[model samples]
Target chain A: MTTSVSPVRGSRDASARSGLLASRRFVSVLGWSCLVSMALLVWLGLSVAPTDAVQKDAQRLMYVHVPAAWLAYLAFGVTAACSALYLWPRTRSLHYDRLAGASAEIGVLFTALTLALGSIWGRPVWGTWWTWDARLVTTAILFFLYLGYLALRRVPDDPQVRARRSAIAALVAVVDVPIVHFSVSWWRTLHQEGTVFGEDRDAQLDATMAWILLWAVVTFTLVYLFLVLRRYDLAGIEEAADERQLERAIVERRSEAASSVVAAPEPVSVAVGAAPGSAP
Target chain B: MTDAAYVIGGWGLTAGAIGVYALLLQRRLRRAVRSLPPEERPPWA
Candidate 1:
């Protein structure tokens, strides 16, 4: 009768199992697509594209540089959104905190790549590897801000307390992103204005170069998506393990208390029986 | 360095960083999965 009312497996657990399988399938497919697209993108950018009139073969760096920049911006944007969701009382979930952290990790990696690629491209063009240009400085600051956000996440504290503090920090750091984006136009800086925005971009880049750049952006975005999914899964597993450890500690403490209570009962009975015999 | 060297260096570093990170993530993920009980393991694991 009890077996009829209760199934061998929980409905919630079964649903979670199915969901995990579906997402795994999706991530694998996306990972393969990203790999194949990147292979084609590398060949197209490195071998087939025409040399720039000014930058020469060094111009090929643009393929990776532009895409890295875009992905960094995108990753931080997602972080900010997830952070916002985490802070809102009605909508808050630990998953939002995990998502924000995962995105920030990827964001930091891409931001580093942006700086490195920019330095490489600049060395051949601007004749120096580093500069105090508005855009460059702002971008460097933005990188450190997110880097600090990652560091802040490491401070040991209560889970809810840590998540709240990190979410606030994330929101504050994201303000630097807009500043980084507009630093070129807002101030007379060494970095050129965006090649593809607010200007005659079509005339600026050859059609083939533009197509290849778009492909690179799309391919890298897929790579970003894949990495975040796996990273978030890792975060979830770690959190679950932490919870299990806490529960086990509580269980062990409770059992110790129960054993101590049972050991005290014999002494109490002897004392009571001795008092009654003495009174008689 | 020549322009070709600069080009190769840039692409090489990007690919190398990405490949290393992917491997590390995969390794950590496998360890995390292995630590879990069979009933609690994720579907992908």
Candidate 2:
């Protein structure tokens, strides 16, 4: 004896249940972790960390700004790697294409955040809101380059064509990342070189503040990972919808063609002599 | 503006930007999941 099961009900049940952290549970865990870590970071960064001798309270902005800049680099790096995987013949797959697109989008968001935070941090420290410094200019260029890459992905085309072209564009655009990173050193610039990894390797930040900064970086990385996962899942669902829509259109067009092919009597025949027995 | 004001503004902007983006993403995911048929809905949705 077989029992009938409602697929909708089963799906809702499965979705509601909490799975292992490797799958569905990751979303909830990551969301809660981001919230908790962010709160802790704010407290540690603002209240606990000692104010800088020169920059004072404004130095606190470094915690978020630096992490954001790092996350941007990380996201773009992921995009480039995924794009390469998608482009290579052996490992080419739609999964890599979607992952590349997702990472690039998140990268753009973080890049925008990095720029804004840098400006905010700069206004008090650097005595200017905007500058054409090497670091700032390179970062801005990086942002726009990825923005253009995203626009390329949106142009209506076959999936494979879009993926192939955008993969190349992603690779091209990622070249700005290292330039942005080394811009402070590459030119006479208003932005200071990295204190942690500068030519003078002695770190400027004290232990507590340094630890908080490190924690913030890790927290932001987790947040970036969470966002990328969610974005990738959304891409899959949206792509599936597109595929279904295309399938429906094909079926509709086939039906319309079939109806059009149905035979019709000649107009001059007058319905085949009035059905052969009607009143003349 | 004071340095404290700048710090607060930067932190606030970070929180707000991330919060808004997450909310928007959740909405988009829900919409996409709903558009697909029951049989086609992703298990994680």
Candidate 3:
């Protein structure tokens, strides 16, 4: 009679299993809400809101450009936070490393979108698609820095080594974000100085337009959160799959070893039987 | 179409793009999860 061991019921790291599920649910809800809110906000901005007297219809680009820039900043901040968590000796966690990698990928996407949309807006309003102004140059540099961070994550095969190196790169790259923000104020740039969330009273627009801009900001923020969460969940899934593959390989090797041990005596007996005139 | 029409068109296009992208992301996530082994599937599924 053979006794079989039941496959370790619910003992295989339940916490990680549950956490992944929760993350998946959270991402789903966030993503759907973002879609609905963005749709409504766009409708309000384009059809119901009043246009600017100075820029006229072209000002509509604000709906897309501002949101893209805002999301880019938010995504980079997330990457920095995750990277710090990954690097801390007492708190070095693979979860944080995965989060950092995922957020950096999304950050690059939003940053590219920001630059492209900004260019589109600038062409119509500034009469040029490209500028050498302080704000524009700083922002472009920030975008490239995150791109470098993403590329770093792909270079190494060892997960722990890759995480450590990428964390260092992310920490160094975050310094550019602040520099980008202060560039417009520190230098004479064709780009307008900070106005929307700053203390520049004269640069402020009318109250209604401000409200519309606020809605746009909120909508874009929701969308960023949604995308980041989704990306993080996907990363978690991939990590889990890799772990399982490793576990399966280990089990297979052990089983092979046990079978070889059990069959060792049979080969010895066959060799002894064929030694002299035993077969004849 | 008036100036308002242009504004509406622009906003509509932006919204549509975002919506499509989000949907595509959802589909990708689902496919990835499905590709995982039954035991390894994320707990939420």
Candidate 4:
């Protein structure tokens, strides 16, 4: 949650510290574009794209799985970058921490989707649901690493302390993303080598399939942008609500203390040498 | 399972997961908005 927030109504920015794309109009446009493009992508991927001569219908899984993995990387990259901003003294702000948390949460979701879709595809292509191959294992490790990052954020503590700890953890967890990507190349494994962004950077994939894959990636990126914007907005409002609650509680406690002091009887006084029944 | 089944399953799972998350986020935002004074609520809320 951002501290020192400006009213969001008719505001160009989300808050005093909002990022460049935090405008309400921009987010709304992006949401509409995401929905339309995603529909187009789905129709083309399922109906228009040519079936693989080898993998048959199972090849369709590539349209979603690759993009999902791409989103996982993109989301985590945003998290790490934002976390760095939070860690830097000059750029330090709670906005970056909330943004990082939002990105990491989306990253974890996409990672799960990637793993699940990959498993679904593997059943037909690799003839197994899962294997202990380097790529699969490394990807699993990356998933858990981010899961740990999210769990760390939930531990009750000072907001700044939590942000610092989460920022460091995000930077550390991001190291595995590259490892997962390169695992297919670094070691001999059951997983196939990357066709597009691999060591050779070959564009050897079929033309129709490649086009559809590219469209899917574009569509998913739009969807990610929309989701992140909405998530950031949600974070802002939720934090505001939390602060309001805290303030209300403080007021209630102060009033209760004041009333108790007022309600107390006056202190009785008597001369030390005087008897109980005698007057001073 | 058939190839068609897996394909459908993968796509369905993606949609379902994302749809559920978006819906839940909307619910949380609405609840939060209700808790705050009108002046403090975000435009999107």
Residue B17 of model 1, lDDT score: 72
Model 1 chain A worst lDDT run, 10 consecutive residues: A1-10
Tens digits of per-residue lDDT, candidate 2, A1-280, equal: 1111111211223222111113667677888999999999999999999999989999999999999999999999999998998888777766677789889999999999999999999999988899888899899999999999999999989777898999999999999999998888779888888956666777866888889999999999989988988888788678777777877898999999887666444554674567867776
DockQ versus reference, model 4: 0.65
TM-score of each: 0.88, 0.90, 0.81, 0.89
Give the CA lDDT, 0 to 100, for residue A12 in model 1. 23
Clashing pairs for predicted structure model 3, backbone only = A21-B44
Scored by Cα lDDT, where does model 2 land?
0.84
DockQ of predicted candidate 3 = 0.40
Determine the iRMS, in angstroms, of model 4: 2.8
The candidate scoring highest on TM-score is 2
Ordered by DockQ, highest first, the candidates read 4, 2, 1, 3
Of the pair 1 and 4, which is ahead by TM-score?
4
DockQ of 2: 0.61
Q: What is the clash count for each candidate, in the order shown?
A: 0, 0, 1, 0
lDDT of 4 by residue, A143-216 (tens): 99999999999897866788899999999999999999889889999988885555767686889889899999
What TM value does the first chain of each candidate achieve?
A: 0.85, 0.88, 0.81, 0.87
lDDT of 1: 0.82
True contacts kept of each: 0.60, 0.81, 0.38, 0.75
- Flag the better candidate by lDDT, 2 or 3: 2
Q: Residue-wise lDDT of candidate 3 within B1-45, one digit each (tens)?
A: 444554455555556656666677778778778867787676566
Put the candidates in TM-score order, highest first: 2, 4, 1, 3
Candidate 2 collision pairs:
none
